[model samples]
Target: MPFRAQPLRLVPVLAALLCTAPAAAQMDHAPARCTAPAGLPAPMASWRNPLALKAGADRKAAARAILTPGRTVTLALLPTPKVAYPVRPAKPGDSVSHGGLASFTVKEAGTWRVALGSGAWVDVISDGQAATSIAHGHGPDCTGIRKMVDYDLKPGRYTLQIAANGEDSLTLLVTRLP
Candidate 1:
């Protein structure tokens, strides 16, 4: 009789555990959502409306899409093999991923920030050499920006290479830091 009562008492506990199992599993797999703050900083405000552009398969083709400073552009990329990067990406992109190139002219020498919405590799090239990145970080919360890389650049014609991106498109912004 005591054994029968013990099993009955455990019935409610077993039911509770079984019922909560699915909810716990769902919580573990749920994607995190970023809540927007009251406002974005000035540097990130232009990212709200990105200009659409197509990336070039090579440096010459990349001349068609010009990257403007302080403006955000969403680039449609090509397969990694199609892009002929002037300077190979320091960190090569996935062979199965996408990449492309675009041109930007730096009018003044300063620290320039390249912001992206994905974890793609960025290479700023000029005179057959790649500019070294000075700093790396993430964008402001809720802005949808995944990474930022800074480079010290002089006034010249440069190529902005986007590589190893998992998606077919990417959002990018090149801005000079004050």
Candidate 2:
């Protein structure tokens, strides 16, 4: 008789494997713990769509909106070579393919809020570590979802890793919390 693989025994092994996967990374948001940074009328940065393409399919056009201070930038967030960083390799069951990069300098050493107009998954990467508190995926405007991440930041430069779940056009804005 040939030996057979037991289906029930595989359940536990599969469950354990999923535990180590990056699923949590997809929904990592901790806004409740966020406190407003100290400073009245903190600096505000705005970027409008510079490409004027009104679409997120063009990689070069989308990259133009990479978060510059006191300026309006525009760009689509698609998976293309023009993206700021190399497209991350996809894993099984992963659907996100669009991403963009932006950098900002914090002048105050307090809690700050990074808000995005459309609902896109955002990662506040600093010192090579991802932020644990991100408040996003809400609102009732275009696309019906907005992303906001409040973070405690010091005086330094930081990068914002943003990605889109679909081929949607939108704008991104960054500002200091009250």
- Best-matching candidate per lDDT: 1
TM match of model 1 to true structure: 0.79
lDDT string, candidate 2, 61-87, tens digits: 434434554343443555534344323
Q: Could you give candidate 1's per-residue lDDT for residues 98-130 as a string of tens digits?
A: 999999999999999999999899999888888
- Give the TM-score comparing model 2 with the true structure, all chains together: 0.49
- lDDT of model 2, residue 81: 41
